[model samples]
Target: MAQDRAQKNRPHYALASVDHALRLAVMLQVEGPLSVSDAAERLGVARSTAHRLLSMLVYRDFARQGEDRRYHAGPVISLTADSQSRTALLRTVALPHLHALVGRLGESANLLVLAGDYARFIGSVESSQALRVGNREGMVFPAHLTSGGKLILADLTPAEREELYAAQRWDGREGERPDPAALEQELAVVRDRGFAINKDRTETGVTAVGRGVRVGDRVGAAVTVSMPTVRFDESRLVDIVSALALASRDIEHDLQAALRVEA
Candidate 1:
């Protein structure tokens, strides 16, 4: 009864149309670009309503219509007084999707970005199982050893990759540095398959599948689902790959939008 009273006493004031319009603005800001139909589906509003809302946002300079006819976050949002860093923005935009992926696949999910010769985990959502991989945020792994890092590496041309490999300073550990020919072969598979997998590569008994997140034809980051080798099943690889691909699209959309806003 006291909880009911507390709930009733809580202040509430919201304008439905305005609230939805603001949400649409946020979606544009975080999810990159959207058409009226996409906004309608995401916002759960009628198409006409979504169109009206977008039009108003465009007028206010809070969103802009691109040459592709998709709606993008406008000057007002980018020029806002908020001092949030790009890294923070990326984490904010990616965390929810990572959580959703974890919920769907019952596996740990991560967002990683290329940092020099390493792939750095910037965000992670851990699985609920007792034996699952723990949080890896802020951790860095050699680019060649990690699925996410390999996907980013595969984005480079053969000559470019060769140049990078030649310039790399490797540790004395045996097999730490990848053979140029073998690495190129692996990259070819990654390109053809549109994803990369690491089985007992980064760590023994751990497996990870990763897909690159592209922003304007460049791989800016990667999204991955990781699990223990004991729990991993090759038969379910298709399902995991599909989930990672979907999440990658969402992240890429947000990344492209963010880059445009920054520009």
Candidate 2:
């Protein structure tokens, strides 16, 4: 029994629950990522207990809930410095495509990556049209309120989504969050369609459509086109979606090639 304990020397006064939580944290930091069920199985605990433990970990920023619905080492974890090389490579491969998208649709295009609970615009190309939306590069927006943000958030599992939008987090800032039911309905639609559309949701008189840039089964980023609301005709939606999809594919292809070369 002592040998099976998390530590070689099990303390007489060690609280089992605390030990379990610590062990889970270690597993997250060392094992990369794991689901609640996986943690429970490994820790020999009940599912509810595992969930409570993981929630506490998230609350303390000891672990983070990933888009894949697994827990990864949070910022507080003492891992090696995160390399910005991936983001740099992604931006390098995606800039040309953003410009091409602007040339094709005559609308501003942006490339964004998930940053914590926000979407960070890393690449942007403004349209030449007099009435077009301007460059939004280096801007960060609430993940739930942006076109690309919603598309990426919709890709997370239900448990991961719950952690991100936990009721307690919105206590004083209720207005900033969307109605749970309405947001769920919209996310379901975005998931089914593999894209998202925004119309005056984040900014007034601006409309946008976004598609995820995928590398194999994982989405690496979101590519979107934003235009003036007056020019956002419902008839043009199909064309906008098609253009956005092509841009996404182009970015993903180049990103894959770049990463392959690096590997």
Candidate 3:
């Protein structure tokens, strides 16, 4: 009966195409580059089918093709390797600051880091209020959809942002995928204001404010406060931003100290 219940809880169907693509993605991450024939042989699929799968991966920035006709992990995947250790360290150093933000703002606070084209919640401190937002650690959301993501994206140069968006494959759902032109404009506002705000953008009735946490010239992470729209007050945004900025600086200081220790 326990086994049966577990089976019932699992997804009933799996798309072969999706499974194939996922397998290929894992291989690319773990084993590095591969050619079409290599992927076909490994997956036991036809070369033509492998090419189609690879094309989708390339379109999504999960993989890239080189002049030698070999496919390696793309910018997103490469960034993952570059940022993984830093992200782990940031999470450890930012936890106390996140808690402090929650105490000051009475709203849930999170530490997010960029992982490829998504923002990953690395640490969080829930608000004390009964109706407050809950912890979101381990959640991954598209970078363009969340305030934290937008804040980090705003740090990238226009050309870098465009390159990141060029091969994206958009979902059919409205607002699931960002329009490049619109995103460009929104990022401009983020840069000018030194922060980003999302009101009912990522989720209905949810609002978030975020600012980038920098390690020198680069944005290393983002600090965010989230609350229900009903509790959101535009008048308090400035104060909230102030609290977050202070918390970011605190985290940044600790991160620098930690790096110096390692050095």
Candidate 4:
């Protein structure tokens, strides 16, 4: 839901290039294939600037150039790994566990990483049930408003928090920002509980539970299980949290083994 709102306020002191890149990425995600000229027009940048940005995106696997010369969502959008970038590796390692989680819980699950102020879902597995949460790969959500996002936010230090969410940064988007004191209290609860649950915080009729995946000292990603709110059972929270933890551990173990092999 990166483009969930149509008229989000521009951040104060926002870098034009970075903003353009992120917006272009979202456009590719939400609107499908786009020509360079169209990208330039959408971003209001010179064609050369758009081309350069598209080149960078191609290099990072965020986009792929088709034979038609249009840019489209790349393998990264589908969580395919070329075994080069760490993000790809993360998705590769996490997917098996995500599928296992879906099998165990009968709910869709996703692996997400912190991307600037948003949480980007890098891998996702949908449940087989006729009525279930759908795939959410390649989507971004405000970090403060998602279960996985809150876990990533809780991992940040106070100074890091200030640096990322400083008032000046949200100048035009003040209405969308979380209350500082409330956010601190919520993060405290997230840290203390070792997991997070969002009951329709980002989307109505959906609920998600998340646990952090740690890579040595830093939390690298979050493993989350999402389901329709009608099926949510608070009484089953403990069991769901346990399954998420097991999946997280499996992913971490694989990541470590992969690193050792690389070393």
Candidate 5:
């Protein structure tokens, strides 16, 4: 009897239904209100399957059906989108700088800021190289493991900095992650250096350099250039530093200008 019950429970783990429901929600999220046929076409599923998935989404507040019978992501998703919009505005202002840096350096340039306890990529520009390190916008990486993350985090107050690491995961390799006291010491060095360097901290072959974007006393964001370690040797350190500092100043000026326009 126990074996039979286990067999019955195994079917619940299939999750095909869950995948369809999530796809329906994402379709509604990106494409706005979608008819059953429209969603089915996007997901390459049968119309009946799409309708069933959307019904489940409605039950979970992930989507809603209007009087026109089109499904839209519900209020819960709208609130999240509103928050993302604020970040999107910052990314828009920083994109030109990021692109210019990538064009000049011939590497991947990323714009990042603190998001909760992690560093979130808000924008990125890549060189024309066939092989490159690319970043997905809005992807979050651990704060202690990236140059841009360290540059931004170093600007936070000591108390705020402690709060940031309280829940952080120290999954970095040996010697890369240290206790609270050690992190404080490292941050001090980063502050003095005016630029942060990550030597294979995030990935084995990736090296990155970053400078903070300061708006008056506060750091609004950071800009980073990521390249393969072989390409980022000490010979290029001076040039990288000069390029990043120039980019940082440009970003700060842009931020201040946007603030004036807003005011």
Candidate 6:
């Protein structure tokens, strides 16, 4: 019984040690270089054990031990990230649908992700028009004033919306950020309407309509079709809204499939 108890405890202790080593590596990645003693202190392990873990990590190129004896994340981990980003499975899956919409409508289409208090434009298909009104890729804009932002905001719970707005300092930033009561009213209408519209809110002559692009239970992102107000009159608005809704559904389906495979 004593020997069996020792055997069981040995594997548990080994796993704990491995866990500590992984924690040390992750800490180095997040907090930059750390001496062995510092890593040991943060992990509540002895210097010798930390040294052994660092050696193993260095051998695998997960970390590099510098002349200063401080450890930092190394090329192997960075290469893995580069590889994953290059794949960009979301963009790959959505491209066909986005191109179809752009080709059919002759208006710009974009994919946006909510980052901090803003919507970041990740990808876009430019309108074929001689004059353009849509945002360029990699542009970041206030979420409270754009159709993509409104689409994302409309899907959030009231509590979640309050938390986001509080962090963003919306009151001071936007001249037209609706008061909480008014925002709540607008959000209710957005939810019922199944899409959101921006009427020259972000830029003077541009108008856009957007719909939520969801992945599973999470509102992963949004899609928008944008044009100048003169080009997108009331009749054209209906066509654009309908096209965006279809494109959103297609993107959501692909996003869900990609996520399932990733899982």
Q: All candidates' TM-scores?
A: 0.64, 0.67, 0.67, 0.72, 0.68, 0.64
- Candidate 1: C-alpha RMSD to true structure equals 14.7
What ranking emerges by lDDT with the best candidate at the front?
4, 3, 2, 1, 5, 6
Lowest-sum lDDT 10-residue window in model 5: 1-10
Which runs of model 2 end up more than 4 angstroms from their true locations? Answer: 1-83
Kindly list the per-residue Cα lDDT of model 1 for residues 88-199, writing each as its tens digit: 5777778888999999999999988776667878778899999898666656787877889999999977776776667345445324556778788888899899999988
Q: Which parts of model 5 are misplaced by more than 4 Å?
A: 1-85, 167-178
Q: Over the full model, what C-alpha lDDT does candidate 3 score relative to the true structure? A: 0.80
* Displacement of the residue 172 alpha carbon in candidate 5, Å: 16
Q: Which has the better TM-score: candidate 1, or candidate 3?
A: 3
- Give candidate 3's error at residue 188 in angstroms: 0.5
Indicate which candidate wins on TM-score. 4
List the candidate 3 regions with Cα displacement exceeding 4 Å: 1-83, 168-175
| Tens digit per residue, CA lDDT, model 4, 1-263 | 32245222335787979777776776565446789899998667899999999999999998999999999877765332331257766777898999999999999999988988989887788999998987677677888888898998999999998888888998887777777888999999999999999887777778899999986678868999999899999998999999999999999999999878877
What TM-score would candidate 1 get against the native?
Answer: 0.64
Those runs of model 6 whose alpha carbons end farther than 4 Å from true positions after fitting are 1-87, 167-178
- The alpha-carbon lDDT assigned to residue 224 of candidate 4 equals 99
Q: Give the worst 10-residue stretch by lDDT in candidate 6.
A: 1-10
List the RMSD of every prediction in angstroms: 14.7, 17.8, 12.5, 9.6, 9.6, 18.5
Model 4 worst lDDT run, 10 consecutive residues: 1-10
| Per-candidate local distance difference test | 0.79, 0.79, 0.80, 0.83, 0.73, 0.72
Give the winner by lDDT: 3 or 4: 4
Q: Considering lDDT, which of the candidate structures 1 and 5 is the better prediction for this target?
A: 1
If both were scored by TM-score, which would come out higher, candidate 1 or candidate 2? Answer: 2
Winner on TM-score between 3 and 4 is 4
| Model 2: residue 160 alpha-carbon error in angstroms | 1.0
